[model samples]
Target: MEQILETLLFASDEPLTLARLREILTPGTSEPRDDGQDSVAVEIKQALAAIRARYSREDSPVVILEVAEGYQFATNPRYAAWIKKLFKDRTSFRLSQAALETLAIISYRQPITRAEIEEIRGVEVIAALETLLEKNLVRVSGRKETVGRPILYATTPEFLRQFGLRSLQDLPVVDENASQGEEAAPFIPDQGAQNPMAPPATDHQNN
Candidate 1:
């Protein structure tokens, strides 16, 4: 069953849920009793915990972590410095000021349309948006219901993982110097938008 879970993790492109693991382990099984479902969920949790422990051993090169309500295997953070140095020149991409601002807009006001973003930034972000999309930091969450169906953008989990955020709320608040005493940037959705997405916008910013 551990092998099964490992295989599922390797094959899954997205986070595999406990219910998903249960389904895979007990194919064609139907709802029997409440007790049965609870028992299975407990088993899966225990199995996942064991797997986590097993991979967290001192010599393990990789470790599994839960993020964005899902589990993924990643290299241990302790080794990140060396890993970065090894690939530093090859992956030495830096965010431009425009790109940074565009990403900030999306991180705060997603699932926001391009028009809405431009309205707030007071400048067209077409090129910066493209760059962010290519970097896998921003993604199209969906299209707005408005006329012309503008595509809404949101930050990806890769954004969170790269930024060392556990979730959107972990994003720091941008204030004072960053926005020049302007309205603290929008960190959540407008009424009727139903988009609960927002990320930290650090208050003490160097950039």
Candidate 2:
């Protein structure tokens, strides 16, 4: 079972949650009720711990990490220099400047409407939102309890994993005395003065 879990974690591109692991590993089984008792969740936890410990050896080249409440294997940071040279195409995985700005807004003022995001950025975000959606970094959390019940957007677990953040609380702190008490600067792109996540450009790539 431990080995199976480890393999799944290695193969999965996303974090594997405890409930998800339990469902796949011990479906239909009753959950352990008593504290310190044996259960599928407990077993999975212990298995993950063992794998993490094993990879923590000084000679290990990779490490298992629990990010966004799921387990995944990551290259040991010590080998970052070699990995960067080996992964030359990694730049394509990064969000464009526009997408980064919109994502930052969503991350901080989550469950926000498109209107609110645009207001913060002072620019339309249709293109940025689409890119973020296609990447699974943002999700439609729910509808706001406002007059029109506008759809609310929020960052997903994938966002946390991508950013190497544990949770929203891990977001960089802002100075309380800053202007509007906002973060020092938004993720404005270099060409933000001209085009900001322009939808035509993003869509034209598919044509």
Candidate 3:
């Protein structure tokens, strides 16, 4: 079971949830294990734990990480320098400062309208929002319920994967010492620590 889990994690480009793992292991069935164990759920947990422990050594080059509400294998950041050299020609998307700030606001206060984001940034965010949308990092979740029913924006799963975050809960804590109405610094993932998935190259347009 551990070997199968390891192979699946290694071959997958995206994170795999426990539910997803179970489906892959035992498709079209929700029945409990016949061996009298707790359940497939418990068995998967044990397998994952063993896999994690096997790669937890100080010299391990790859590690299992929970990102985007799922588990994935990621290269160790310590070896990032060497790995980057091999993928130097791969396309990477770089976010502008304006877009970064807008994204930060949306991430912290999601299901928000464009007007609400503009209100906080004190400037128009159309271009920044467009850039984010083009990059598939931000998405239109739905519309607000109030008058006009303005569109609401939120971060995408790609955002979490790109930033190597397990979830929004992994976002950096907002500074409490800032003055009222001050815009907090945006959270930027370390270039060296980003997930190995490289987004397609697009024209670099400043926001």
Best candidate, lDDT: 3
What ranges in model 2 sit over 4 Å off?
Answer: 31-39, 90-92, 96-98, 142-149, 166-207
Q: What's model 1's lDDT at 124?
A: 94
Where in model 1 is the C-alpha error above 4 Å? Answer: 10-14, 30-37, 57-59, 85-89, 147-149, 156-207
Give the candidates in order of lDDT, highest first. 3, 2, 1
Cα deviation at 154, candidate 1, in Å, is: 3.1
Candidate 1 lDDT, 1-207, residue by residue in tens:
677777888777666656567777887666423364577767777787677666654335555655554566666554556677678778666999999999988987889998998998899999999999998999999999989998999999878755545578866576636645566645343111121231222222222
Candidate 3 lDDT by residue in tens digits, 10-76 = 9999999877888888897675443546488788888887666656533356778777878888876
Model 2, 1-207: lDDT tens digits are 778987887788877777778778878777544354756678778887666555553335666666676667787655656677688768747788999999988988998999999998899999999999999999999999989999999999989887765567767765646776465643222221122222232211121
Task: Evaluate model 2: give its lDDT.
Answer: 0.74
Off by over 4 Å in 3: 29-38, 91-93, 173-207
Model 1 alpha-carbon miss at residue 144, Å: 3.2
RMSD of each: 10.0, 11.7, 8.5
TM-score-sorted candidate list, best first: 3, 2, 1
Error of 1 at 180 (Å): 9.9
What Cα-based lDDT does every candidate model obtain? 0.69, 0.74, 0.80
The superposed Cα distance between candidate 2 and the true structure at residue 56, in angstroms, equals 1.3
TM-score of every candidate relative to the true structure: 0.62, 0.65, 0.75
